[model samples]
Target: MAVRHLGEFVVIVCLTLVTSGSSYAEQLPNVVFILADDYGFNDVGYHGRLHGSAILTPNLDRLAGEGVKLENYYVQPICSPTRSQLMSGRYQIHTGLQHGVIRPPQPNCLPLDEVTLPQKLKENGYATNMVGKWHIGFYLDACLPTERGFDSYFGYLIGAEDYYTHMRSYNVGSKTLSGYDLHANKTTVYQYKGQYSTHLFTNKTIDVIERHDKTKPLFIYLAYQAVHFPLEVPDSYMDPYMNITDKNRRTYAGMVSCMDEGVGNVTRALKEAGLYDNTIIIFSTDNGGPIQSGANNWPLRGSKGSLWEGGIHGVGFVHSPLLPTSVKGTVNHELIHVSDWLPTIVAGIAGGALNGTKPLDGYNVWSSISGTASSPRKEILHNIDSLYIAPEILPSYFDGEDFLWRFLARVLEDKFDTSIRAALRVGDWKIKTGPDASASDVWQPPAESGLHTIYPIEKPNQKVWLFNITADPLERTDLSGKYPDVVDEFLQRLEEYYKGSVPVRYPDPDLEADPALHGGSWGPWE
Candidate 1:
């Protein structure tokens, strides 16, 4: 089989296909995909981080106890890239989102041609719906989730929004676009003014489940905005974490608590709807935590946006009442990726095959996840530092004072062959560089609570480190010089993967260059 790139807290469900036989083909389990934004490795209780730690996630812990925890799940370091991979069942590189993110006013979006998970589920007779953040695209009406695949789409379009006011702001060119972004299937739901976003999304998910037509199985993607940024939570939620001391950490903990409550509410709704046991639920974080946002990836190196395990490895689990009773509460050490969910879900529900225009990077990992067979994944392309930027499409500021921006522009526009950062894991051995061999700080978490900040430093002549992750989960030791052959083999594999990646795509520069055309607003919709 081909190689693929491939951790998390617990939430609870077990989905067993009544019989291993095909007699009940029409009785597909309802699929509930719950995604947390900017969550971390040690943040969930099952990871042995919340016992006495500042982090608290009881719902996730209970879920972990009743479900299967994926100890080695992988995602991209950033939000949009991971979301793109999750939806399309391919790497971000294959979906034109190899670098940075899809910021506001940029017309760039997931290519419409790519068939998303919801789209495939819909094709198989499921009532597909989505709630919360949809950061892939929004400039064009066609790029919206409803038009893409989902029958309904609710929540904010940008990467982050004020949880209370549902407002978002983005700066591009000279325009700073700000507006109330809560929407219901492309139309803004103005009546929900001042409501906390976490609660709102949860209530909507429950409502969808309650109102769903039972004749057809449902596919609900509850993508919560909680715990991301603009860190805000209700007093009730924040009150429990008063002992956290640090204001940001306190609020962050509250946000997680509130979201955990929401998860409880949703699962309760499933039971109320008489669909709990026959439903398949998967809970996962979009990406690693960003320290700037009060997130902690304790004991793991690096924060969000870095190429370290802490940045991409997240808390995740698979729960379904139908899952084999014996494997319940088991920890699956199998390597898995966010993209694998699409095919896995499709196969789980109707056993349909992938018919996307491009070949998929995800595999049907149900066998491994269910403990019925070994994992098909052996390696993964962590990240490749390359983007096909179109210079003519960039604003005149391409030559401006921002050196990092300028360097990125050069890489994209000039088609420069520069390997700024790359990592690949073949078997238990992995190799990576800090922005193309220039050393970057390996962030280590403090032993106790304290304010900390990391500043990136360059070491142009720094040596690359290799680790046997199985022997060193913390990635503390460097075995490069000790195992030269392993490093060489992985490097060759990384290069091969980079050579096959698709070019990056961006929005029309003209659309973002004009302040009046930048997409955003602030008034309530009638």
Candidate 2:
């Protein structure tokens, strides 16, 4: 049970935060969290993919040199779950959304009960604004970004929308909300007349910052939609890609460059607003880039949707005025997870409830990485939640096609609790298992003869893999055969986490009555 401290008071005061061990600073620097969509680790100039390893982003490169580069950052294998962890500070399993698209009336989406980062920060006097793709939970007035604590919400409620069309498949109470609503909270904000997703999101960010309550600080959650899918890039901007060898990749490069410029614009906005000094800015992507769609996350295998290191290991740069010049440009290789953002930002602001802060599954990565202190994370956790079918379990997941997407979608559509999978990574080691209980979709023998891999037993269901990710990041080695003890130990931890866990649900909030109030509810969606 959470002990609610009716700290419902919203106070905005202008003062400096000093660390002389002398006085307490009243005003906190504005925080801007820029989460880009489908940006691979090697896509930026800082990480070295910009301009096809040719042209460079002087601004972004300079930003990394000014901030701390997180060398071992890990997000979810996909987007919505990553957003859930970033906002709720909970593991993906804790939230209802285990896999696939998060639509309205999605009983599996983040239960209306989880408290989001903005909800916590808003209580501390910052005006919160969210603009760009929000895949955390359902889509509706109740499940929208504002309901999750953002003062202003602008962005698509779905995964990927057409760059020009701004159209997407949707469902409300099992019915879709298409066409008009896309413009309501998404595509139309900031007078986004005809700009592509990358450009419009950037401009909206500036507008939010410019129109912010200056007397009070601001917390801007800018999750941009670019380089994700539908190959949406303005012809004028993408025509340059024709000169490149690969058409798809060339276009991807153009989209990424546009996102880089968008980021550049935000920083300039900070400077213009005179908030750059004390501001704390973070830039990261929701997941790995698309391998089929011209993504270059080499040296690491797998793309968006898989459990491979490439799928989860994205890049991060933290630039806060609080750090010393020496700490700047210092790369911290600590294993940091996305769940850490909420608690860390809350701690930094000296706001909300940290007393019984649920021993968050994530650490305040900045504290140690920024030289405030030093410590190393023992293990990290990630989940694809890709398979939550019911009634019966399938023996294998299709490595290539998305027939599985439709299949898994139906498992929930038909209401069945058929799968459970969890993982624990001790250093570079990992373990995962499928739910063995349930009367749902049992795997039938393949008419073809070559389905089984190792022992060649035609079993109903089994999916397990262990790897020394640091040594074999692509996960091709399959160290499970060689390191049984390492696998056993991590597997024990994973099981313990599963058996000892309680389900978490997103809470509905009376935001109109009190914009910062948070509540949640949870039940068996199947």
Candidate 3:
């Protein structure tokens, strides 16, 4: 066994496999990582079993039923953080992306020195291609996908954009500026102006699959911009969801269905290209859904921007014909984070080397996914966001009859500063510290269900919370009062993580990033 130190995590590599001849390398599996933006926990069809939900996802449900469903999967609370972690196989704190999504005007992106998953796969002879959203960064050519080890790239540089026009608008100081964001290998292409992005991305992926050579393994990162904000979809797609009374939800469901159909089409393309047997398709959401925008994380608390279970507990699954017969169609409850994908695919499946990369925070969880062994990971550092601002407490909270006594009791019992928005999970225990009032913190059932649950509002001063997440997945009960020792231990762990974290990389919006200065398209401006 070759022991490779990856920052704080020690990765044990098998020398025999690493030194093997071409015969061993030829057996590597083709990987297709499909990432959905702002997808909710209870939005998929498989979860419809719980409440007879109306949201439809036939292709996604079929994919999960044929593969292993990751019931305990986790992702960051927002887009850029999860993408950075997935690409670098490191936590957001290590990458200095611990704050928020990469703004369109910020001159910030994934560090240039970081070895991305695609770059590593390419070194092992895989053909790396990317389609759809690339939100990590775009202030320089070095930050573009093609420059970062991808053989070819087709996508938008920033996050949200108009689905049809492919236009994105950003506030540059006092003026709002808009530009076309669609790109093909660093070139802005205007031919796709009227094409729907979901279908457009799907077609491009199929083209890649159809043109791929069978001799070499393939890697595709299809990061769909579906089901995010703006809530736009073709009328035909929304026709089936007329029963959904909420207009935003109806559009949202249509967007999900469109993405699902694209998945099915891509799967068909893989089969037609004779790559189905050796391909591994992994589907995951970038973060939890924002309930205010027609998304629901029913029975789970919080939305996209918070550290609550609903915000970080993501939807994920691995679909491949190569999975063990016994593990097929089963749910794996082992803990798995988004960062684990790099090692799980690059090292575990592709027989690649991680020798030159920086220390990785991810673990190779292939055995756990394959039902051969338990997950090597037991703890997940969800985040330590120093820049997070808790919502202002309402005056009603202070005006309550027993507010004085309750406030005193909380002040005395609090073990850590709640003003710092941070969360950590160890074993079954999860601790949250900081003031979080995201309004979307309550459970949001499907709009069509006409159901709502009232949750207690957090007091302005109350910050620390402890919960045995496994026992109370809904987060309805805070055990900070019942377990002082657990709270102390978790707080200590958070402090340790904070001490090692890099300073946040959030930069002020650069005026140079204005698309008006760059041919009416968002691209490298610095």
Most accurate candidate by TM-score: 3
lDDT of 3 at 478: 91
Candidate 2 off by > 4 Å: 1-26, 49-56, 104-108, 170-178, 183-193, 349-352, 355-359, 384-422, 432-462, 501-526
lDDT (tens digit, per residue) of candidate 1 on 32-151? 999999987767766636423466688888887899999888888889988988898888767778877877667678988888998888888889999999989776788888988899
**Model 3 lDDT per residue over 56-90, tens place:** 89999999999999999999999999999999999
All candidates: TM-score: 0.86, 0.76, 0.91
Q: 337-383 in candidate 2: lDDT tens per residue? A: 88878866776343555543344666554456555554445677675
Where in model 3 is the C-alpha error above 4 Å? 1-25, 389-416, 457-460
Ranking according to lDDT, highest score first: 3, 1, 2
Error of 2 at 413 (Å): 33
TM-score-better candidate, 1 vs 3: 3
- Report the lDDT of model 3 for residue 116: 95
